[model samples]
Target: MVTIKDVAKVTGVSPSTVSRVIADNPRISPATKKKVREAMEHLGYHTNIHARNLVAKSTKAIGVIMPSSADKALQNPFFPEVLRGIGSVIHERQYSLTLSSGETEQEILAEVQRMVYGSYVDGVILLYSRVDDPVMSFLQERDFPFVMVGKPFEKLQEITHVDNDNFTAGKQITNYLIASGHEKIAFIGGSKDLFVTRDRESGYQSALTDAGLPNNDAYKIHTEFLKSGGREAVERLLSLPVRPTAIVVTDDLMSLGVLSTLEESGVQVPRDISLVSFNNAYLSEITRPALTTVDIHIHELGAQSARALIERTVDKTVPSRRIIVPYNIIYRNSVSEQ
Candidate 1:
């Protein structure tokens, strides 16, 4: 088995120098580094990350905590797109990524604990934020280096988070509906437990208030982020007396189900009921009528969270950061004038 010692001997440098070269210590001269690396390649000396981690106290890896099980979360295109963004930065930094996805909150917390206690990764990126989240509490109590992709339930000044201005986004999109002559507008969102949904919903209500439109409680529906959730929300809305003229859905995935269900019920999109959604997922563009939605820049959110967490891991004393990625509206055929 090739070892650092063999490379050191061939390169005529001490084993310590070989180790330093492996660590890419800036103190080592570039010429010496080049020579050592050439010898390492020639001798087939591959680094054992386990040993290196033991010495440096770093795994050179980051853990990504998904909000739900992989099978369920990946059904929404948002997850894949965000992961691609995170992966881009991770790859550029020459770091590895570990995804921790569990079926429930408890299971997810357990996976996070393992990642931290077992020294599996240098830091973690939480993909979702919940009110009074045990996972967030655990990371806080341990003073573990981590970042969230959504607003924290509390301690906004202390926890590092990357998110869009969802409140403003919601209001802007809702205002667009109102300007298009939609007086009776309804809202469909994910679980109220998520701050994203709550903030967006708040903005939606605010828009209605400003426009002097009644913010009817019956017009608001909360469900899961899946297409099935959209389908379910549509069923409820359809049952309402004097149905809304337009709807604002919090997720593109849910909007897909909403469109399908509305069609199945013999309701034509735009012609009968207009819809606007969040997250300009790829499918949004290919749908029959396409979709008028908010482009929350899901990829940028992931990239920023990973970058922030990496910075925190490198220097634990660095102050927490709040990164707000900008968002814009993607106009499509889903919305029409009432």
Candidate 2:
């Protein structure tokens, strides 16, 4: 039953001053703001966010649109870690997170539109970046505030995105395979349309070329970056006349699938075929061989994305930013000398 009016009366300040204090407005003097805050705490004053947002024209809620049908969002180690970072920063800032997923592009766009124009969220953070995605276009056309988690193929200078040097990560893994004495190496990747896929593939190709190795199309495979996809890619690679001695999988989940198929096919890991994967998911560590993979700092990626989105939302005058988190290679039992 405690209200702003009660706190204002106790603190000898107007209700509007109490409101500004609650919002941590810099215009309010620190001493007055501290007094108002203490009065609010003493009176157990709770804010009516709906009414407040209506007055301020902001929901203080950020909409997060992830690939709903990916099914792998929860199963994928990278996403959960990134989410943790996002959640931590949002919570600390006293903001709310609204998660949305859709089966189709139209559905996702509809959800985003609803979140924005419907006044459900002040801004949005896209979890995936693709070439000319409708959702990205919609936000850009209207000049709505948003941030993407991956780089976009087009309009690199126009939009804000948070990502790591995926090209370098891919090349590093490929170089590791080559250093291990594996002349024939294969690749299992996610969707070809994805920017991450292209960046990684480019890295893989660059490493092969630099090492004076032939880049065989037969050794390259494109999959959904899931366990089943990895399994299928491995099956196809094994059926080839010249099988690869090692493989670089773009996702840890797919790597697990490849390992499962390899085990069933009586291929001893590192002894018969070495493997390297990305994301450094928990599954990587739990695998029989404890996969050697790249750590993309998933949590930090999420946190940074949230921060970028928040900054964009709050300060419209700030220029678009492209932030690159760091990555490292974690050596483990999944890779061995040829």
Candidate 3:
């Protein structure tokens, strides 16, 4: 058992100095930290994370709550990319990540409660935002440290969150379709309860209003963020008396389903119908006649949320922040000049 005292003696530093180095305390000078770390490594001394956490009153773990079950969310590439980003930061900071596994809202809430009450995590990162979410309310009531990856339903200025300007992105993408001569444009979005869908849909409506285009309620379809949702949405669009020539899908995964369904229906993309989507996920490029989409920087959204949550856990006095990541349009082969 290589103890802190043994490493301290070997490095000619006090045991307390060695402990500070292990804790990564900023008060320890860089040179001393390096020396103590080297000596600890040479002596094969590994700090007991559990013991350290007990003393520091920190689990050094972060909880990530998904909008849906892990099985469903993982189907979308966005979630995986975001997790990768979050993991990168957590790994660097020597923290662990605990993902919520519950499949329903109630179950998820229970999982969150367990994480908080059981001291399983130092903070939490919410992967989605909804109106009057119980999870959000519970965290607020407890004054627990948490950060959301999307805009809050209310208290826009108070809740710490990391998100893209979804409304602007939506308007810009729709405007692109309009500029390319698309008058009858359709929108396919995820659940209406989600803040992302509402914001983007509002932007789409705003763009239509600005262009003096008809805003047909029938043209807007809301479904899950999965491929089947896109497929179902396309069925509705095709059955309409006046089918749209361009569609702005809120998710790339759903767009894939739209593309497949359209192909099966003999609707030539861009010739009969142009398709654009959000999230420049890898699959967007591989699809035949690749999709024109918005790059929302999903990874950055996750990384920033984790960073903010960690900051909050460290210093609760820090003011809440709204971090908005930028978006860019990836003009691919999916859109055509109508």
Candidate 4:
């Protein structure tokens, strides 16, 4: 119930000065700002966020629109790590985080519209990037500021995004499999429309070609980045007349599914088939054979996204909008010299 008026009275500053101090306006003299802050802390005065937002025309809140599939968001360690990174930066700036999940494109778009138009958030961070996404298009059309965690296939020049070089990560994994003496390698990846999948697939093909190995379409399977999808892709690959000696899965969760199916089939890992995966999630380390994976720095990715969004919200003139995090490969027991 403590209001800015009480802080102003205690600090002997005008209500407007107290308000400016609360807003962290640079115009307020440092002495006045310090006194106002001390009074606020002493009196336990918290500004009404809604009222402050209305007065300043900024929410000091950021909207994070994640995939509608709750299971995907919960099961994947990458998302949590990314969120952690974002939270770290946002908390430092005293900004609140609001998360919204949508199952369909339409639902997501509607939610985004509401957030942008209703002044619920100053900006948004989208976790997934698809080719020609309606959400991206809508935001772009209105000139609403937003950032994507993954790169979109189109509009590479138009929007700000943060992502690791997925194509390089894919190629590196593929090369690791090849160096282990595996010629027949299969790919189990995420949705085809997603830019991550496209980039990784390109990397896979590039690695094969560079190594003088034929890029066989039969060995490639595009599925959801889930355990079920991984299991199905592995099963299909195993059923092929020319089975793959190794597999490069785009997601760690999907790699777990591949492992499960392989174990159920009585196939020994690394001895019979080697595997590599992305994300380097905890599941990779705990599996029967610790998975070899590419560490895409998920937490750092999230943190960077948050920082970028905050910067855009604070100052529209800050340059160097696009940020690309780096990736590293973790060699594990899942792969051996074949």
Candidate 1 lDDT over residue span 109-227, tens digit each: 99999998999999999999998899999999999999999999999999999999999999999999999999999999999999999999999999999999886999999999999
Shift of residue 253 alpha carbon in model 4, Å: 0.3
RMSD of each: 6.9, 6.2, 5.9, 6.5
Give the runs in model 2 whose Cα sits over 4 Å from its true position: 1-54, 70-72
lDDT of 3 by residue, 23-86 (tens): 4644579999999988877877755545545676898899999989999899999999999889
- Model 3 TM-score is 0.86
lDDT of all the models against the reference?
0.90, 0.85, 0.90, 0.84
Task: Give Cα distance to truth, residue 235, candidate 2, Å.
Answer: 1.0
Which candidate should be chosen as best, given TM-score against the real structure? 3
Residues 1-338, model 4: lDDT tens digits:
67767777888887766756654554578988888888887887655545555666988899998865555576777777788888998888889998877778898899999998898998899998997789889988887778899996677777789998999989988998998899999999988998888999899899999999987899999987778888899889989998888999999999989999999998889889999999888788999899999998888888888877776665554443568999999988988787
- Ordered from best to worst lDDT, the candidate numbers read 3, 1, 2, 4
- As for model 1, its CA RMSD to the true structure in angstroms is 6.9
Q: Which stretches of candidate 1 lie over 4 Å from their true place?
A: 1-54
